[model samples]
Target chain A: MTSVADTLDVLDQAGKWRAAGKGVALATVIVTWGSSPRPVGSRLAIDDGGNMVGSVSGGCIEGAVVKEALAAISDGKPRLLDFGVTDEQAWDVGLACGGKVQVFVEKVE
Target chain B: MKLDTLHALATARTARQPVVRATRLADGAEALIYADRTEGALSTDGAIVAAARRALADGRSTTVEIAGGMVFLHTQTPASRLIVVGAVHIAQALAPMASMLEFDVTVIDPRRSFASDARFPAVRVLQDWPDDGLNAVGVDAATAVVTLTHDPKLDDPALEVALRSEAFYVGSLGSKRTHAKRRERLLAAGITDAQFARIQGPVGLSIGAKSPAEIAVSILAQIIEVRARRAEALQAAA
Candidate 1:
């Protein structure tokens, strides 16, 4: 688990980005399964326009995750996004593994 | 009086570098400072330093009474960051493990040939001189600076800058004798013995590492050990 100080650092930096009029959303990987790209507690930050500062996966499902994160940012709501490599939608989303991953998307103020 | 004492207590607990909160024995301002840095308080500098040092050494969180007030020091290591001043072979192996260890790794070197996406795909590689590169990354208490160039023209200037920064660990890849000679050069350039003491010569622990990757592992291992030992010491003090 990351320390409060570290999390605060990210929040503080994100705040600066937001102050600069950038759209920033915080995406946290809450769960992962076999062969998942990122472990739980991994974070990927996305700006309002969909520019990514970090990665939630090993580049496996970032495109889909970013879309979800962007939607959450626009709606000012949180989203729980799940993707499994075995699902047909996973193929549509370009995931190549049987492992499942869960991401929580929250827009940063 | 309560607020004053609480501030003192917090300062006392934080002198060693752990994150601590001091609740006044009576009632007053809540003084929060990292265990390693407790300043702007009266009559508690020594205590804060002692407490922080002890808490950091222990690597655990604790609640205690300092100057008759309750204070808590959390001896958790901040995410370690590695600032490599050169993009050499050793850095390639070192960067990934450091990432695995949760270190925010940044490689800085002016040589475009050495600092390229192909060489450091997973790490942030900067094609700038060490001085400018380090400034961009913003060295702090949680950062470690390693000079791997072995060239005085490059390593010396880099060491000169890093020694003055807040980076907790500053090591150079060289033998002790080499460091001794390097010290002479630094002294000529106005770096004092006290400042020289800040550098870790012979870089990593005496692990007899031969290959670049092995040496990189040894270096990071030493960094982690130093971090852990600092936590332990702080815990004991608390």
Candidate 2:
């Protein structure tokens, strides 16, 4: 379950990283279509060192979202990313069939 | 996401206040919305604010297409509360389990020695008597109250308060005969038949549980079942 404590833990980790002067980015699942393992508001916090916590599409799309988050941290530009079997990358990591998600990555300043 | 916004959200969660994070899809511009106030440029936008409030009411997150762009409303309400009205051995097992499942667990007992930080390290241990403790915790629609202290002195008062309030699950630990006696006593004390029926005496799914830990598992499973059914009913009504 995506409980409140999980959200607090993720955001607190991001805050701590930012306070420690580590560049941090936050990735949130803004939309989910057919059989998303995680819900729409699920989040992942990524630090500049490539350290990550939490999940967006459980596992299939996380590696891709983390890459976007790291890039967002470097450039300070937000990105809205999409992944599923239909999209390019096809996840080939396998969302397998429909399970599409729209993830928004933003730098935590 | 701004640090101050993140900090404010942490503060709201600590305070158990329902809050919504509104993000504009076109730009990732953000705002935090509380029932009484709003925290960013979108504060002036009635449509998004209303959407955020609706999100809070249903305890679900969603995306809304308002003019200019799309807005995502991520609603975060306090974790559901579980008040275990005893610091008995079963509670020692149950409290941590409930906490692991993200319930804000509270162990209430008048015995300070029993309801101590040593016993319930992860959960709040309230040393107040049953009635006082339940009132202090404040039962709501998301709250679950269980009486694990078999003694009527400890369990009945808590059961009375739980039944009168909106707490979604009211369970008392006892045998079938014991529960029959309990029903008689509560009826004498003026609890309605319908209200009396809400008490799940022999409280647990009939899993043939023998040990305290096993019983705790059964109770937790039953609570989860009740919560899911209630959520489905509420969604259907909506």
Best by lDDT: 2
TM-score of each: 0.50, 0.93
After superposition, the stretches of candidate 1 with alpha carbons farther than 4 Å from their true spots are: A1-109, B1-78
Model 1 chain B lowest lDDT segment of ten: B21-30
> Tens-digit lDDT track for model 2 on A1-109?
2334444478888988998999999998888889888888888999999998888875887887888898999998899988877877755656765788888899997
For B1-238, candidate 1 gives per-residue lDDT tens digits of 1223333433443342345443232222234455345543333556755765665555444445676564434343455678998888888888777776768788888999999978887778898888888888888877899999888887888888888887788999988788988999998998888888989888987788999988988899889888777756765666
The number of clashing residue pairs in model 2 is 0
Q: Evaluate every candidate with DockQ and list the scores.
A: 0.03, 0.48
